[model samples]
Target: MKSYKDLSKEELLQLQAALEAEYEDAKSKGLNLDMSRGKPAASQFDMEMDIMDVLNSSSDYKTAAGMDCRNYGLVDGIPEAKKLMADMMGVANADNVIVCGNASLSIMYDTISRSMTHGVLGSTPWCKLGKVKFLCPAPGYDRHFSVTEHFGIEMITVPMTPQGPDMDIVEKLVSEDEAVKGIWCVPKYSNPQGYSYSEETVKRFAALKPAAKDFRIFWDNAYVVHHLYEEKQDHILDILAECEKAGNPHIVYEFCSTSKVSFAGAGIAAIASSKENLDDMRKSMTMQTIGYDKINQLRHVRYFKDFDGIEAHMKKHAQIIRPKFEAVLKVLECELSGLEIAQWTEPKGGYFISFEALNGCAKKIVAKCKEAGVVLTGAGATFPYGKDPGDSNIRLAPTFPTPEELRAATDLFVLCVKLVSVEMLLAQQA
Candidate 1:
């Protein structure tokens, strides 16, 4: 296979003609496949149908601590659910963990809202401050940026390496800027790239001497227990434990949810941090509402039983989604390999595979796929402000569709990539 860069104008024109014909034939199939979000398939949902039966009209509604889950008293959460979430997040104990509403995004949004109205701990409120900024690692979660941007906080783009965010830039920016209030991190099996922070990256995060006392690492361990390969799992240094060791105990607010593990919107979410940080958040939480849905929390506790049970359940999910991932990868390797015009991350875990097309090729590729009856996440969605400066990265979600659907979608995707790459190269040639 010749690299697309090495092809002559005539060869490029010939290849483009062939790929465009494939695209047209694909469009005629009336396919309406979507590879946008990392949504679990309907077939996978059938395996967890028994979760509904875990609780019934006659079942015991009381937790292990003797509190009736049917009631609304436990504002934080029942002990067992906390234990499960804590264990899943790799934290030491359930003491500092708070099980909240179904979405971790809600918890995340509220965390920022609290900082806006009232300061973190004793620091001045972000709303009262002159300027607030955040270090955003590129090819990062879009929602994380949405949260910060919603608060009108300035976002600084931090480059992401295979290990983690560029820490040299992170350390300098954090230590010098008092208004650099926070940094968003997925730590384990990160969104899109599934790249876990190395031990050193975690240590540097823990050891940072931020100029602002309110600065925190929004460590979203959303995929801590989400591993695709049992033998080749990614390990991250526990930020909570490491922060304590570094005397920066209040430097992180870790979040996790069973959104992917169990139900998406109906899942239980949680946040873990130091006692002081938890206490401060609890003070604000007390005023937010009477209490969260403990009944649903109880359902999760009863369904999974323990972290080990949750791990076993995820393995079943992996079995269902892994082939879809492999199908996309196989097509990429077959069609795009040695093209010298693209690169991508092949993660062992997490729900997405991140691909990088040639400069200015991402939007064209996504538009091309959509025009052919396939929908994909917008090209720049993985970066801050929904703008990938190079217009190169595209997030491929292989979890939502069946193997056949995925194969068809990948076929279209690669066809689009080839067509777009040739056009891009031709534009450069002219």
Candidate 2:
């Protein structure tokens, strides 16, 4: 397992020939596997089939507070659902939480849209401003970048560490630029890398004095409870609470959902922020709809009951997907460890693994994998505007594939990586 960079030209060419042969054989298998998105497998869904039975035709439609869920009211969400969501977000007060429809992404999109049209807490609408910008931590969630990019917001790339995004840069850009409106964060078990924000990073975030009063931290804690190992979980300070302690209560808007916990398309989502922020959002929300689906909120409350129930259910999810993560890690370690051609994250809780390949090799590797019947997320999808500056980072989503399918797909993936690395080294030699 010589490092690809150290291989002699003759050795590289020989390795290239062998890897090309392997890739050709893999192509002949006629396999089709998709690892593009972090979606739960059917087996995880099959295990929780009882949630449908939690509510039935004869079940009472009234909330514990005696409000009929079938009617149009509780524009934010039901009380029980609020408490459940608040507890999940580590917020003591349910007043800060507003549970929405099945996806947190929608809440994020609407928030950005609302700011664009109206403004944040009566500041000038973003559309009225000359320039609006957002800080995006690279190898972050693509959808988050998409939402901001769609609004014509400029995105600044921030390098990510195991602890979180580089805070010094975050602090500098936020303080110096009035146009820096917000930053996208997946604080706990972040997308792709599975990195959690450090306590110091969260405090630094809370303590920032942004030039823009409208600056907000879009904290998408999408995997707060998604842990692969019970003993090896990551936690961080509650951003809302930290902001309150730092006297910046309105500086962060946190969000979460049960999209992965229960059903992907049908689960409760929420946004937690200061009362002032909530009030401002409510003004716009009141006009958006008479109310959201209250019966569905009631259904979630009845099914999960509380944070404890959600925790227990997520443990079951860990039991299923944990092995898939380990399988991908094992292959990466066994095949690519000493090759010095790649590096990958070993996440404890999240749905993805971030792989860093040799410079200028990511796109070629992805194209090679797709040619062999294994489709991956586009090479630069992790960065803003679908551009990875080095063209070296690739996101690996192992949750959707079965254990056997994962092995085959990963096997092809490594074969492509090796073939690409060999070619890259041979070219460098010439």
Best by TM-score: 2
Put down candidate 1 lDDT per residue, 1-430, tens digits, no spaces. 7899899999999988898888889889998999889898888788998999998999999998799887768889999999999999898989989999999989999999999989999888889988999999989998999999999999999999889999999999999999999999988878889899999999999999999999999998888887888899999988999999999999999999999999887899999999999999989888987788888998899999999999999999989877887788888998889989888889989988989999999999999899888999998988888889999999999999888888889988988888999999999999
Best candidate (score: lDDT): 2
Residue 340, model 1: lDDT of 90
Candidate 1 Cα outliers beyond 4 Å, as residue runs: none
Q: List TM-scores for all candidates, in order.
A: 0.99, 0.99
TM-score of 1: 0.99
Each prediction's total of clashing residue pairs, residues at least 3 apart in sequence or on different chains, is 0, 0
Residues 1-430, model 2: lDDT tens digits: 7788888888888888888888889999999999999999999999999999988999999998899999988999999999999998899899899988889999999999999999999999999999999999998999999999999999999999998999999999999999999999999888999999999999999999999999999999999989999999898898998999999999999999989999999988999999999999999999999988888888888988888999999999999999999999999999999999999999999999999999999999999999889999999999999999999999999999999999999999999889888888887877
Root-mean-square deviation of Cα positions for candidate 1 versus the true structure, in angstroms: 0.9
